[model samples]
Every structure is written in structure tokens, then in C-alpha cells.
Target: MKTQSVAIVLHDLRGGGAEKMMVRLANALAEQNTAVTMVLLTEGGVNKAELSSAVKLVELGSPRTLSSVPRLAAYLREAQPDRILSALTHVNVAAALACAMTGMLRRLVVSERNTYSLDKKVNTGAVMKFTYWLAPRIYRRLPNPVIAVSGGVARDLVETESLRPKDIVVAPNPVLTAKVLTMMDEPASHPWLQDPATRVVVAVGRLSHQKGFDTLIRAFAQVADIPNLRLVIFGEGELREELSALVSQLQLTERVDLPGYAANPLAEMKAADLFVLSSRFEGSPNVLVEAMATGVPVLATNCPSGPDEILDQGRLAPLVPVDNVNAMAQALRQCMEQPSDNAELKNRADRYRDALSAQAYSAVLNGSVTVWGR
Candidate 1:
């Protein structure tokens, strides 16, 4: 077969779940001998270094998604890629409009990375709210396949966005990769990892309200009686000071560590005994799959869209309600006391290996399979 050209449209190379997944997918597709190009709306971002050398990077020069539409249309007219995959709502809307403006026939696949209706609770800015409100109208009119990271997210699209059920495809995020597995063995310099007597519980994500770090801190304080136990949260966001204040007020400052962001978090997760994801809601949590891939016992809040599906209906790991301090504390206590089967956790994580996801997406791009209706 002739080499197929693929382009991934993204807002930027930010340190978010969607950006990270797009980079991994671009790399994976390039490795498969598929010509991969990343069309970024903005300039340099934190994960810009993570892009594979084989993949081409196209910077649109526009600082905003809406402003980038003309640039995107120009690129589509010039490159005429075999397929285009866009991530998140704002960029997806831009991609759809760009394609309409350019009249390109390339297969366009837009992905939803979060439950937008739920995300409004954390970020209800006028622009974001209006964008999401207008998304369904644009998405419904566009003749493109939509990829939802989880079943819950797909349902949200249909129920909230009024999208057709047959138009959305449920594709979990690709997380487990050779690089990630190798990174797990890399040495971590954290004291909690170095101290053999220290029992560590780790959570990785932005330090924002959506991540529910405040709830995690309260839950950790409730379990302060568990000696030698430590809570470490990785990632940076707007709520760092608020979370820090809560930790200090609870008098658990010494026991909890908020080390901001780590470029290689898998190594730290591998060293920890337990992993927790306290998100208010998620599309498909990459951290959940990453923690499980490291053979670490995971305790995720049974948030909409990802945890229940990723955890095999709570068989792979313990699940708690979102923002429930008491439930999280109870689950944390029981999990700390038990021995989790590493092999089983690894098996669960295997379902989300990058190779499988890349192959599925490639098939979608190739139009060999219909990726709709659940």
C-alpha cells in the first residue's frame, strides 16, 4: 500500500492528558510507516520535546484556535493529508470549520477528551462555556467521525450535545508504551522513593479543582493515623496555593508532598506503593492506565467516563465516589493494608497499550472499519 499521510490537530503541546496522547499517537503512527504531521495552533509548549523526530510539526503562528482557522485551511489545501485527527472541543470546532472552508475531503476524526458539561464546574469561563454550547451544533453538521475517550463521554455527547449515537466512536486513550515502561525503571530522586520504610500514595495530574486535590488532601488528613504513610501529588495548576493551605491547616504538611510537575512521573509511580486519581470527572484518564501499567495498586474515584471502564467495573482497582472524603479515606485505608496482584494490574493496563490504540486509529484513518455506534 502507498504510504498514507496523517495529521493531528492540537491546540498546543501543553502538559495535559489530550496533548500527551496526541504526541504518543503521532509517534506511534510515524513508526508504522504512516507519514505523521502535527498541526499545532500555537507555538512551543511543555511537551514539544516529546514529539518523535519522524513526525513533522506545523506551527500555524496563530495564538488562538479561532484565529488559526484560516491558517489551518491553508495547510489543508496545501498538504491535503489522507486524514486529520483533532483533539478537544475548541480545536475540533476549528478543524470542522477549517475543513468546510477549505473543502477538503480528507477523513476528519475529532476526539472528545473530557466531559465538557462536567468540566464547567471547574472552569465556567464565558468563552469555554459558549464554545462547548456551540460545539454540538458544529459537530452535528460536520461530516466527520467523532472519537470519545470513554462510553460515558460518548453518552454525554449524545445526551448533552444532541449528537447522534451512530456518529460517535468509543476509543480509550493509548497510554502504555515502550518508553513509559522503560521510564518506570528509571531512578527517581524523591526521598519517599529512597526511604524503604516510607509507604507512599501518589496522584498525578494538574493541581486544579477538577483533579480534586483538595478532597485528596482532606482524605489524607483523615488517615494521618496510618504512620509512615505519605501522599505525593504531581502536576501544576491554579489551585496549588489553596491545596497547600489545606494541607497546612490539617497539620499534615510534613506528610504530604506537592512536587508540582515531573517530566517522568511513571518512574515515581513505579516507586510508590499506591496510586490515586481523585478527579471530579474524566474522559479516559491516562494516569490511571499509567499507574496500572507500573503494576502499582490504584484507587480512583469512580468518576464518570473513565475509571469504571478502565478498572473493569472496579475489579482491577478500588473505586470511590467523586469528592467523597470519607469514602476516599476508607478506600485508602483498606488499600494500604492489602497486597495487590501486580500481574493482574499489568494485565488490565495492557488493554490500553499504545500499539493497539494506534492500530485502531490507523484503521479509522484508512476508512477500513466503521468506528461508530459505541
Candidate 2:
């Protein structure tokens, strides 16, 4: 067998679910003695340090990916890796354009980590509309495999972009990692988590409209009068001020805490009584699976693509409608009353183990016939 050189391209090693998966895959490839290089279209992010020494890091140092096309094409022309994998919309488009410009024969794998149609539906702004308009044109013309992290995402591509099933590979996101297992045992420093009497509900994601943190805040407000309960959100994003104001408006200033971005959210998930995902839409949420891996019960808004598939139609965990405060509140009450069994939840999470996902991805990179994420 010959060693293969692989390049994983992304906008950044941001704390987003897709970024984390990219880092994990790159690390896994390195561990297998494959030459791995992480190509970032941007400079820095929280997960930058998470890469092991075995993997090379190349920063394009561009604020936006459009400006980085020449740099990306140049890197591809010079490095000439056997395979290239890129994630996210902007970065994927950039990778496609770069590969085209370089006219490289290297196999290119691009991923759509979100449901474009649903995301556009939720965010009906001019920018989002333009992005929706532009993405399909690019994806339709791309000649390589398009990785969709979930079946729903794959279906979206077929329906929205007119891509064939053969062109889309539905590979589930890698969830379990050695670091995650190690972190699960580590204690969370929050005072609420330490209290045996206190029931802490945790939600982790960027503070954005798509995440529906405001909806989660409102749902928590409905149950705030419950004794020994606290809502702690572990993330930071553009909506911090708006979400904080909603918390204040609901008079949950003391009961709810937005501690910004947590470097080690697994510890918090391990310690917390429950984990919730209130996203308006998601391709495939890593945190939902991570929370289940920790043996903590999960409550997620059954929004596009991921949560329903993850929760197995609400058999493993509870699901609510997107932005439905009353429904979310009711579901929260029911969850508090009858928590999910830890072992069962962990069993569900076991399906997305990193080893399995890594092997599937490795097969793709090595040009092996593979079927996954069915």
C-alpha cells in the first residue's frame, strides 16, 4: 500500500460543528500515517490549537474565501495532493473554483453541511437569497462527489439543486473522539453543575438566529418558576446582545447564564442533567450526538435535516417544533418529569462513532467503493 496525501479545506477551524468534524477527520487521517494538511481559507479560530502536530496547517490569511481563490488555487497547484476535501458553502465554492482554475486532476470532495432550501426559508434576507441562488449553480456544475452529512441534506441537494443521488454521498458526521471521551470524565467548573439539587439544562451552539437560542430562552422562561432549575447556554455569536435582552425581558437574568463560547463543552454536557438543541435548521448537529454520547438526555427542535434523524423520530429523545415556544415549553416539562435513560441515549450516539465515520471517509479519499449514511 502507498501513502496518500490529503488536504482538508475549510474557512477556519471555528468551533462550529462542521469545523470540529473537519479537524477530527484530519487528525484521524494523520493517525493512520496518511499525510494530512488542513487548508484554512481564513486565519484563526478557537479550534486552531486542536490539530495535532502530525497534520500540517496552511492558512490562506484571507478575510473572505472569494479573495482566497488565487491563494487556494496556488496551494493546490504547488502541493498537488492526491485528494482534497472542502466543507461549508463559501469554502466549497471556493474549492470548486480553485480546482477549476488550477485545472487539477486531484479528486475534490466538497460538502454541504446545511440544508440550503431550509436555511433560505428561515433566513429570507437578501444575502441569504443571493447565496441560495449562487450555490446551486456552482454545485450543479462541480464534477466531483458532494458530501452531505445527512440523508436530509442529500435529499435537499437532489430536490433543490437537481443533483443526482450518485453524485451525493451521505456520510454521517463523526461524533465520538478520544478527547471527547476524556473530557466527559473531567468536571465542569460551573457552580450549578456541582449542586446535586440543582437541575441544569444546557444548550451549546453559536449565538445566532439559526440556532434559535432566543426560542430556547423563551421556553426556559416558561419553566423558570420550577425549583432548583437553571438554563446555561454555552456559546458565543452575533446575537449575544439580543439574546441577553430577551433573557432580561423574561426576567431570567439570574436563572439563565450565557457563558459565551466554552472550549470544553463536553464536560458541561457530561455534568448537566439535560442538553437541548433549538436550531431553526441544521444539516447534522454534532453537539446533539455528543450530548447523547455523554449519556445525557437531549431535547431538540425537530428542525431541518439532523435532529429527527439523530433522535430517531423522538424515540431516543424529545423533539419540538422550530420556534414553537409553547410546544418547546411543554416538551421541556415532560422531559423534566421523565428523563431519558442514559444507557439508551449513549447507545444511539454510538452509531456515529468517529472510528466508523473516519473509516468511511478514508475509503472515499482512497477511492474505494463505499456506501454510508443511508
Candidate 3:
């Protein structure tokens, strides 16, 4: 029998959770003796460190264009991997279309990482909306399977869209607990980690409206009266200037720190006293799972998809309403006053261990399962 090969496609391999998940999956598949290759649509934003040596990195060397699609389709068709898993919605849609155009339909999995509706805001204008509206129809016609990162994401796709429930699979983001533990065990070299007294409240995500760092800033400011508490947001995006302005306007210049994309966020998550997810919406947040793995008590805005589901409907951690500064402040205060048992939280998180998630993905990718969502 010929050795099986799989290609994981993404727009870029920058520091987002979805990108990290792709890297993890690539590494895991490679370790299983599957010939794994990672194809990045853009070259400049690749995070070289996150990927393993076993996995091959193929960069298209530029952003995708109408001209590039045929070239990309040709490349994949020529490679003819046994399976192709595309991460992120836009990339997934593109990969599916490209594969269809090229007539390479062995196994194509489209992973939806965020809540479907937020794509509208992420890409404004009528053209973007039209594309989004057309995406479901286009996706439906493809021979590929759809994978939702969370059950909520799967539900949204099937219930709200024209997609068949049977075609959408929910494979929750895998938690690389061992890797996270190793990173956490290492000494803190970052200047922010040097101080023992600094009460670091960390939020990990791209600096976007969806992640709701602005609301986190507002909540942090309200509780700024608490001495030694510092807010650090990891990850980068277009909202850098806006978030900076908000931090300055709140007069939290001394307290708020925007680290701007830490390649290994688990290090920061482990060192922090608290982890927060203030997203306006999410599909399944890998950061929340990672924080839980680090035994850090998490406080998240009860956003769609990931947080509530990961937190087990607020039984594990505090869930505040989205953009509510007062409620968020109160939640933070409560967390400070009464800390959850780190050991218990870590134990709960261990259930979603990387090995289990890898097995689930392996089963799906290997054609052992038909459907994967609730």
C-alpha cells in the first residue's frame, strides 16, 4: 500500500489560535507516519517556530488572487494528497473550491474556526457580504466535509444555513497539554514575567473587535483600583492602534500591556493569576482550553460557540455578558475574592488532552467516522 499524505492549508501561520491548531495537527499527523505538508497562502506571516521539522512547509509566496487560484488548484491536484484539511473559513472555502476545480476530491475537510456570522464584519462592504452569503451554497456543492471547531459552530452552520447537519463535523480544538506544560516549566525570560509581584491578568487572541479587548480594557480600568494588577493581551491584528488609544484614554498606560503576538502564549497563561476571554463572539477558543490546561482560572464573556461550551456552561469558570463592563468587573472581583481550585480545573482540562483530540481527528481524516457534531 502507498503511504498516505495529507496537506493542511491556511492563509498564514501567524500567531492566531486557529493557526496554532493547524501547526499542532500537522505535527501530530506527521508523527503518525502520515506524510504531512503545510501550505500557507502567504509567505511573510509564517510562524516558523510553531511547526515541527517532520512537516514540510510550502508557501505560495504571495496572497491568493484569481490568477493564483488556478495555480494553487494545479499544485494540489499534482500533489494529490490523500487528504486536505483547510483551516479558517475563507481559506477553507478557497481550498474546497480549488480542489473541486482541479478534480482532486479524495478527502477535503473544511475547518470552521469562528462563529459564521462574524465573517461579515471581518470583511466589510457588499462584495464581502455577497461572498459570505454565497459561501454556504458554494460549500454545499463541494464534495468535501465541513468540520466545526465547536459544537456551537456546527449547530450554527446546520440550523442557520443551507448546509446539511450530516456533512458538518465538530472536532473541538486539541489541547497540547504536554507541550504547554513543558513551556510553562521553563523559566520566565520575558521582562513581564520577571516580576513576582505583578498580578498579571492575561487575555490571548488577535486584537480585534470579536476578541473584545476593548471591553476587557474597560473592565480592567474599572478594577484598576486593585493594586499591582496588570492586563496583558497577547496576539496581534489591525486593532493595535485602537486598543492602544483605549488603554491610554483609560489612563492605564502603566497597567495595561499589549505584548503583540507571543509565539508561545502558554508561557504567559501559566504565569498569570487569571486568564480572560472577552470576545464578542467565538467558535471554539483554543486559548480558553490552553489556560484551563495551565490550571489558570478563566473568566470569559459568555460568547457563542467555544467559551461557554469549554467552560461547561459556566460550571467551571465565570461567564460574563459580552461588552458589559460592570458585569465583567464584578466577575473579575469575584474571581479575585474566590479562586477556583487550580488542580481541579487542570484535571478537568486534561480530559480534552491532545492525544484524544488527535485520535478523533485521525478517525475523521482516515474515514472511520461519518459525522462529528452533537
Candidate 4:
């Protein structure tokens, strides 16, 4: 059988959850002997050299201006891959429009990484809201399927817009269990990890507003009296100043550490006493699963589209309401007081193992299963 070719389209090779997932999927697909290429819309950013060597990387350079759509379309037509899977909304829209014009892509898959309705709350400005409102209509006209990262995301797509259920599919993010397990076995090297007397509580994600790190800081402040507890948030973003100010204002400078982004966060998670997700909203949080894969107890916001489902209704990890600092604090205390069985948590995370998800995605891309309808 001839292997199908897949091209993953993204804005840039940024070190975010969605971008990481795209790289993982591309590599996983390529490992199956399929031709996989990552197509970047922009010329430069952080690149995913972590991807398997078998996968190719292609940058289309900067689009120059909004007027360069024709050039982008021509480039896709020239590449002529069997399938094109796009990661973010702008990239999805661009891929759809480009492929629509060229009619060269046999299958187009758009991965929606956040709750669809949250766009209204996040976009804020009337113009941005209007653009988001028009997304479902534009998405409907595009000649491809939409892949929602979670069931919450799929439901939001149907309820927030006039999108047909037939056009959307739920494909949760997969955890690279083997990589996580391997990293967990390695000795801790981070400065925070070396302190045997300190109890580490960790959160991993982009340091953005949506991550609700502000709320996490406030929650940590309430528990500052907890003996030797240190909060370490791993990831870089634009909100560093704001978060740092909040930490100082709350007199938690000693308790809270914003260590930018760790290339291998699982090692930190393994060394930590607790893992937390303080997002205001999410599509599917990859770190939550990564933490669980490390057999560390997790406490996450019961935000839309990810945590509840990933935690299996709190059986795998404690889920608290979004932005409830008090609840978050209480959950953290409970986790520390009576930690869940690590073996059980690792067992539950098996569902999100990389190989299992790769096989599921391969089945869909290979036409063995109808991915959109379900």
C-alpha cells in the first residue's frame, strides 16, 4: 500500500501545546512510514527539532503581507500533498482558503485548540468578535473537516455557530508516555528539584492570561504558610511582568518561581510533590496528562473542554471550578494531605499514550474510519 502524504500547517514553530502536538503527530505519522512534512506560514520562530528525523520541515517564508495569499495558495498547490492538517485558527483559515483555491489537497483537517465560544470572551473588541462570529460560516464553506481537540470544543462549535455536527470531530491531545516515563527516570537537575527540603507544586503552560497564573498566584498566597512549599510555573509568555508584580504584591516572591519554559517539563513534574493546571479555559491541556503520566497527583481547573474529561471526573486528578482560588487552594491542600495512588494515576493516563492516539489518528487519515461524524 502506498503511504499517504500529510502536511501540517501552522503559523510558526512556537513552543506551545498545540505546536508541540502538531510536531508529535507529524513525527508519529512519519514513523508509520507515511510521508510527513510540517509547513510553516512564517519564516522564523522556535523550531521543533524534537520531531523525529523522518519528518520534514518546510517554511514558506513570511507571507510578506495580507496580499500574499495568492502566493501561499500557489505554494500549497505546488507541494500537492494528499492531506493538509492545520493547527491554529488563522492557519486553519489560511490553509482552507489556499486549498480551496488550488483544489490540490485531498483532505484538509483543522485542529481547533480552544473552546469555540471562549473566543467571544477573549477576542473582546467588536471587530474581533465579528471576525470570530464569521469563523463558523467561513469554516463551513472550506473544503475540509474540523478537528476539535476535546468533546467540549466540539459541542462549543455546534452551539456557538451554525456549524453542522457532521463537520466536526473530537481528537484529544495524546501524551508521549514513553518520553515522559524516560524523563521521569532521569535524575533531577533543576535548582528547584535539587532542594530535598522543599515541596514543589508545579504548573506548566504558556505564561498567558488564559492560563490564570494570576489566580494560581493568589491561591498560592493563601497557602503560603504551608511549610517549605514552593510554586514553580514553567513556560514563557507576555505576562511575566504582571505575574511577577502579583507575586511581589502578595509577598510570595519566595514562594513562587516563574522559571520561563523548561524544554523537558516532565522531569520537573516527576520531581514535584504536586501538579496543577490553573487555566481559565482550555481545549486540551497536554501538561496535565504529562503530569499524570509521571504518576504525580494533579489538581486542575474544571475548565471547558479538557480537564474534566482528562481527569475522568476527578478520579484521576482533582478538578475545581475555574478561577476559584479558594477551591484551588483547598484541592492543593487535599492532594498534599492524602495523595492519590500514583500507580492508579499512571494507569488511567494510559488512554492518552502516544502510540494509542497515533494509531487512532492514522486510522482516520488512512480512511479506515469516519472521523468527522463521531
In candidate 3, stretches whose alpha carbon ends up further than 4 angstroms from where it belongs are 1-3, 62-66, 125-127, 189-193, 370-374
Against the true structure, candidate 3 reaches a TM-score of 0.89
Where model 1 places Cα greater than 4 Å from the true spot, the runs are: 1-3, 370-374
Better of 1 and 4 by TM-score: 1
Q: Which of the predicted structures, 2 or 3, would earn the higher lDDT when compared with the native? A: 2
Give the TM-score (vs. native) of candidate 1. Answer: 0.95
How far out, in Å, is residue 223 in model 2?
2.4
**Candidate 3 — what's its lDDT?**
0.78
Q: What value of lDDT does candidate 2 attain over all alpha carbons?
A: 0.85
Give the Cα RMSD of candidate 2. Answer: 2.3
Per-residue lDDT of candidate 1, residues 202-258 (tens digit): 999888878899999999898989989999998888898999899899998899999
Evaluated at residue 351, the lDDT of candidate 1 is 77
lDDT of 3 by residue, 139-227 (tens): 68756567788888887888777689777777757666467778866554456666887777898888877889998999999898888
lDDT (Cα, tens digit) per residue for candidate 4, span 48-119: 666778988887776532234566687777888877788776666677667778875457767788887885
Residue 143, model 1: Cα distance from true site in angstroms: 2.0
Ranking by TM-score: 1, 2, 4, 3
